[model samples]
Structures are given as C-alpha cells and as structure tokens.
Target: MIKSGISQIGGKYRLKNILIDNTPYHEYFLSLFCGSCVYELNKKKANHYECFNDKNPEIANYFIVIKKFFKEFEERRKKGPYTIISRYLYDLLNAGILTPDDMIEQAIQFHYKIKLSFASQLKFRGLIPETTSKKQFITQAKKDFKEAAKNRNRTEGHFKNSLGKTTRPISNNDCGILTPLNPKLEKRLKYVIIEALDFRDLYNRFYRSYYIKKGLTKEVFIYADEPYPGTEKYYGNLFKPEDHQDLIEICLNSPFNIMLSTGGECGIYLDALGDAGWFIKEVYTRYSTNANNQNLTKEYICMNYDIGKVHKMVMDNQPNIMNYVEG
Candidate 1:
C-alpha cells in the first residue's frame, strides 16, 4: 500500500482495516477532513471516484505539489545539500518572513516543519530531540552510557544491567528518512481531487457536482474524521463546538451514507447522534508514544445506516441509497 509521509495526531491510519471492513457499498467516496490522508492512502480503492478534502491550505498544496510538480521537486531535493532547517527558519515561515516564491519550496518547508517538530504536529511547539547535531548527540550519548553502565553493574537481581541496553543515541539523523518526497506517494495521488474549503462548503459542492448533477444513483459514502472535540488546539485549523454541532446536523440530514469518527468520551456528540437515530460503534485503540504512557482509549464511529445491512447491499448488487427524513 502507498503511504503518506505526513504525520498527524489522532490520524486514522491504524484503524484503516477496521473502517474498511465496516464500510458499506459505495461508488463514490469523499473524505471530508483528510488530514494526512493516511487512511485514504493505505486503503484499497477499486473502480471508485475518490475525493480528499481538507480545510488547511498547506495540506492541500502539499498533495497538489506531489501530484503535479513531483519531478521538479525530486530533482531540486537531490541537487541541494541536505541541511536541517533551524528553529529560526520555522519562526520566519510562521511570520511570513521567509515565504517561498513557489509552491515546491513551500511544500519543502512545510514537510520540514512537520518532520522535525515535536510529535510531527503542524503547530511549532518545539524541535524534536533528533534535531540535535550528530556529533554533539553521539558525544553526549557516550557519557550517559558510561554512567548508566556503572550504575547497572552496581545494581542487583532481575533489573540489573537493564540501563544502557540501547547502544544507539536518542537523537540521530533519522529525520531525513521521513521526508514526504516518495515517488510512490506521487503516483498514488495522481488522480485524486484535492480541495481546500470549509467542510460545509465541500459537502454541499461535492453533493451537487458529483452526486446530484452527475445523476449518480448508486450509494455515495462520506467518511468524516474530523478533529475530535477538546483536541482542536492540536490542529492548525480549528473545529469549534458549534462546528461539531453543525456537522452532526448536516450528517444527520444528508442523503449520503455517513460514517463519522470522534472521541468515544465526547458526550455532546454521542448524545446528539444517538438522539438523531445514528448507530454508534465503539472500538479500542492505543498510542505507543507520548501521553505519559496512558495509551489505551476508545473511539466511536457514528454511522447513518446499519452495518448489518451492508452485506445485503453487496449481495443484492443493487443501489441501496439512504432516504433521509425529518424526525
């Protein structure tokens, strides 16, 4: 499967199989909030029209550059010396002091900020430990290893020598490997339609342009993975509480088959969707990094149609369009 180099917190990449397995029959698929697009890139698509939309301009531009200007981008990166971007450059980019003259450079800078920044978050909180210079990190690692070895020798029993087990330094030159410049990814995005617009506008535009006007009578599915409530601060763009409420209302009223994912504990969202007759499926997920080792959490998938009926749609080999009605 083709992979997206972009990393996003709370991305649906890990849950791709669970989602694909549960998804109903559809001829057209729309990703309303396609951050990182990890799920889209990894999942299989057969004879289906796919549209990936995100409100962030940087993200939309990144995909566009990959799809169209990839040949020039590859040549430029290969010719230029590999120098790590500094925190000052990051600040300048944010301040608009070092705005690039072209979209390729803009994509380069954007990828750098995401890969080198802490947690791969778009917002610049701080540089990762791996951003440190190679020589300095190696020297520090040696000193720490010696001290840890001495302490391990002094200790006893099952835990003895557990420290300094890793010979590699915490900070290294691994960031270069994470560059979002893969040719495979460029091929994957060759035919994808990317858009940077408000979520509501995207929904309305695609519904009219692709479904209604095109006379597509088959079932159309929209996969919405909006930023979970209370985690809006992590995104460069915001999804306010009112926006969440609006999304619920829109999804509830839309004729398209909808599957929306959000935090399992968000009571406001769960309560609203439940009262609106939406089916909520809870799944357990884990995070291996960060969060003070509190790794396990629940994610809820709210769907407009019963997944049990999904097999019928496939078996009957007929269009099972949803009929939206007012309560």
Candidate 2:
C-alpha cells in the first residue's frame, strides 16, 4: 500500500492494524469520511470494490490530482511519484496566468493551505495555526489541549492565539509526503472510487444505483467512523447527540452490515447501537500521558457488532491497539 504519512485522527493509534484485519471486504466497501486513512484499507489487495468519500470538494479533487500527477511524473521519472514539482506551470498558476479550473496546481495549493493548520483536527481541536515551525506550533497548540485533558471539565475549542512568527512560508513541503505508488497499488487506484458528496446522498446513491446495478453476490459493509460523540467541540460541529441519533437510525435501516466506532464517552451512540441489536465492544487505547507523567488518558473504541464471532477477531488481530498511543 502507498501509505500516507499524515498523522490523522484515528492514525494516532494502532486501530488500522486491527481494522484492516477484522473489517469485512464486501462487494463494495466505502470509507465515508476518509482522509489519508484510505491507504490503510488499500494495503491489502482488494477482493472487491473500494471507495473513499468526503464532503469537501477540495479533498476529493486532491485525490484526483494526486492520481494524475503521479501518473504523469512516473512517465518521465525513473523511480516514481514522490515529490510534486514546482515548474513553469506552477509559476503560471501563481501569476494568475491560468485559473484553478480543474488544474493540478490548484489541487496542490488547496492541500498546502490545509497543512498550514496546526493539527490534524484543524481549527476545531488545535488552538493555534502553523504560522511558525512545526515544533513551535505544536508547543502553543498543546496549551489548551493539555488543559482540557487535565481537568476533564472544561471544553477546549479552537486555539487562535500564537506569539511566534512563521519561520518560513508554507510550500509543497508543508503538505509533506507525496506517497510513492507501487504498480499494484497504482492499478488498484484505477478501480478505487473517490467521491465528493453528502454522506446521505452517498448512502442513497449506493443503494439506488450501484447496489441495484451490480450483479455481484456478496454482502455490503459500512464502517461509519463518525466524530466521536462527546468530542464535538474538538472534531467539529457535526455529530452532536441529535446527529448521533440520526446516524444510528440511518445505519439501522440500511441493508448493509454496519460497524460504528466512537468514544465510550459518547453515551448516546453506545446506548442507541447497543439497544438496536448491535453488539457493543470496547477497546482500550491510551490517548496521552497525564501532567504527572503517567499515561492516564484512556480513549475507548466502542464498536457495534455480534460479539460472539467478532470478539475473537478483535483480540487476535488488534492486540497492540491497547498497548500504545502517539504521545
């Protein structure tokens, strides 16, 4: 798999190690809010169709350009696509001689701007912006983060204050890691479906169009990793208690096999999924170390499935998920 080096939300732990092992590869599998985590799923050879979707068009376009950029670069280059070149075409785009109307440079710029964000959670959890060196930015960003984790009482939102000046300008380097593609991975990319659409629209379209049209005989599974329920102040303004209810209702009605993951702190998701005939399983993960230097912050992974069968799958496959966290 062409692994992305971005340290994403779920990428903080060994969830992917277990997720890839236990996750069912249906006739079609889709990651509804995939950021860079798509690489983890693609690590294994696809037995069926694979898709990743996000509501952000910039994100969607970023993937499209990534494929294109890699392909073009691979033609002339000996090894493969690793770096995004800033050439005359890039200069033309910057000079406004050309527009971002479906161009590769525009996509790179979109990715660059997002990287200026201080942390993976962006303006939501990160209290600061990357206006300075990464080390400095993280130092300031963790002020409120440490506070929230320390007390467990106060809600920490976006941190907007920083005293340091930017050491250097944001560039292609800011985005980092233009993941090199292997031939097998590149071939799979041809089949991988990436879309920009509302999750509900994606759900409706899959059932109404692809599900009905494809003659394949296999089950469909949806792993909806929504914003951890109570972390709304951190993960952004999407999955509140009401939204959690809506997500559960949507999953319950769908014909596809579903597994939803959230923090045990999300009482609403746990209660609703547990009550709705979905098996509840919790995986302990260390989130961070305490002010006293002991690793006390435990993040829970609550999953809804049939424990009778999947319990073994979880233990055998994802053993180390409980052992470590990115500190």
Task: Please provide, for model 1 over 1-327, each residue's C-alpha lDDT reduced to its tens digit, 9 standing for 90 to 100.
Answer: 466766777778768777776677777778999888877775555246778998889889988988999888766654543245466766776678877779988776777677655556645544544333445656887888777766665444543564535755464454653344667788788778888888999898877976678766336788899888877767644566668888887887788888889993488879988998999999988853452343778899888888887642232233434423432
**Model 1 misplaced stretches (Cα beyond 4 Å):** 46-48, 78-82, 122-171, 176-181, 214-218, 288-294, 311-327
lDDT of 2 by residue, 1-327 (tens): 445323344442446655555555455676677766543344454446667786666567766655556565333332323234444433454457766544455554544334333344432211233343455646755664555444443238633323223222332342442434455434555667878776777877777655567643235666677766555665444335566666777777776666666663677776776677676655666543211222324343334455345422232333554466742
Cα lDDT listed for each candidate: 0.73, 0.53
TM-scores of the candidates are 0.75, 0.60
lDDT of 1 at 101: 72
lDDT score at residue 9, model 1, on the 0-100 scale: 71
Point out the worst 10-residue segment of candidate 1 by lDDT: 311-320
Evaluated with lDDT, which candidate comes out highest? Answer: 1
lDDT over C-alpha atoms for residue 193 of model 1: 88
RMSD of each: 9.3, 13.1
Deviating ranges (above 4 Å) for candidate 2: 5-7, 10-13, 38-40, 43-46, 72-102, 114-116, 121-185, 210-218, 233-241, 286-304, 307-327
